[model samples]
Target: MKLSKNFTNPLAANNPVIVQILGICSALAVTVKMEPALVMGLSVTFVCAFSNLIMSLLRNGVPSRIRIIVQLVVIATLVIVVDQFLRAYMYDVSKQLSVYVGLIITNCIVMGRVEAFALGNKPWDAFVDGVANGLGYAFILVLVAFFRELFGSGELFGIEILGDWYTPNALMLFPPMALIIIGCIIWVHRTINKDLQEK
Candidate 1:
């Protein structure tokens, strides 16, 4: 039951993006298109999951004074691995992502989970929490990208979908539009999950 909650909570009630608003920068930056957004999401999920596991495994022996430094090293190492993997196999998408991939190292969701949850939990539980939080962030990214790419460019993944008859809305391509969409998402989400609303 505890493990299941760890895995499920972040997906909705405790979503890292919509509820906690933790990873809004990447969500806005990469969600210009579905392809990059999806890639970014997967990359984060992998890094978050493994970083938590590794940090949790090391939590015992690491000195409290150096805990943040150690956690950063672990997170940075994973970000490097992901960055290289993207460069090696997915060069085009990687080029599109640019430095945002490396920026994952500083993502609050990743570091926050390592400090907040992984430091206390067993490795397996920590891993699940990481995966759940990562997915929560990813879910918002992909959804925002879907609308932006479809309406902004009349395309999804670079293949035109809306056809020539449908005029692409240039405003949708901007960061402000992403924020508006995210705002709408937050409004609807809070409406359904009323507990998230301010008392």
Candidate 2:
């Protein structure tokens, strides 16, 4: 049951994006398009999950003074590997992602999990927490991208769903629109979780 909570909580109630607001930069940058947002989400998921597992395994041996450095080393290695894989397998999408892929190294969601949870939890639990938080972040990204791509471009994943008569909203493609979408998401999230609003 505890493991399930680790995996499930971040999906909604404890969502890293809507609640903690840890990874808003990528949320704003990548959601301009659906495909890049999806790729970025999966990349972040992989990095967070694996890094957490590795950190949990090494937690006992890591020197307290240098644990942050150690976590960075692990995270950087994973980010590089993810970047190389994207370049080789999905070159065009990777090009779209650009520096944002490398920026995953600086994503607070990744480091925060390692420092706050992985360092204290068992490997399996930490892995679950990482994946859940990654998905939480991804969920918001995909939601925002879906709206942005659909209304902004009159398409979904590059395929037009809106007919020729339908005109796209150029504002949805902008960074400010991402913020608006995110704000809407938070409003809805808090409305449903009234306990969050109480505090």
Candidate 3:
């Protein structure tokens, strides 16, 4: 029951991508390849979840005026830790992701949730909400990456699927494609979850 809630909550209702429009920069940029996108997604999940937990723990004593600053320090520390870990163990992927990994510190999704949910919740519940939102953002990201990689490179997870004759579409690799795919996903998501549009 917990796993179901964790994995599925982000895909709709409180979807980080659609409902919140969080983390779209990474959603557009790193999604050119499946493996990289997956890694990016997981990294965001770890940072967001842990940062939420830590922030929730400190919420009570944090000065109301400095709460935003406190949240940034915690989030940045986690991003640096993740960056160092990725560099030491996964250098190639780290290089590909480049500044984007570091930029996670500024990702609105992280800060937005930290301020809105984490500060108000118990530590464990904050963690769950963070993971759920991160995964929800990732779900839309990966789904877009799935199509972009498949059509743009004729591959998924770096495996050729469209045969040799298929010429990959260069346009699909660009950010515009990400925007289009996200638009379509939003359209469909809103259609099914019509309450969002009404709101």
Candidate 4:
């Protein structure tokens, strides 16, 4: 149950990037390419999961007044570690993501999970919360990457999808298109998950 906890939350209701819209800025900015988006997703998942785990371990000792600062410290440390690892190993993807890797420190999703769920839960539950949110964000990031790459570049993971006659639209490569796609996704998702529709 401890391990499973780290894997499920992001798949459902409390998904950091989706239901809460926690990291849309980065989600939109880096999702134009599938490879870069995948790197970002994996990096975030690592940072979020470790941050939650560490934060949960320290939950008992941190004074209420200093909890936020402490959480940031933990998150920043993990983000930097992940960034350096990416630079050393996946240098190509790192170049594409550029400063966005460092910006993960400011990502509300990571900090939100640490503060909201990790702070109150045991280490196991916090790990699960982090994983779930990571998967949740990954799910949408991949989804957005799917459409963006397929149409913007006539490819998915860089393979042609539209065949010979199809012309890729340059607009789809721009960051603003992510907002339109995400809006449509929300529209369709709300239509399907009508229970979430604003009454």
For model 4, give the 10-residue run with minimal summed lDDT.
Answer: 5-14
* 137 Cα displacement, candidate 3 (Å): 1.2
Instruction: Please give each candidate's TM-score.
Output: 0.98, 0.98, 0.94, 0.93
| Overall lDDT per candidate, in order of appearance | 0.95, 0.95, 0.89, 0.85
Tens digit of lDDT per residue, candidate 3, span 43-81? 898999999999999999999998989999999999999
- Name the 10 consecutive residues with the lowest summed lDDT in model 1: 19-28
Off by over 4 Å in 2: none
TM-score of 2: 0.98
Q: What are the per-residue Cα lDDT tens digits for candidate 2 across 20-83?
A: 9889998999998899999999999999999999999999999999999999999999999999
The residue-by-residue lDDT of candidate 1 on 1-199, one tens digit each, is 9889888999999999998889898888999999999999999999999999999999899999999999999999999999999999999999999999999998999999999999999999999999999999988999999999999999999998988899999999999999999999999999999988998
Error of 1 at 110 (Å): 0.3
Clashing pairs in 3: none
Q: Which tens-of-lDDT digit does each residue in 135-162 have in candidate 4?
A: 7887888889888999999998887778
Q: Looking at candidate 3, what is the lDDT of residue 39?
A: 83
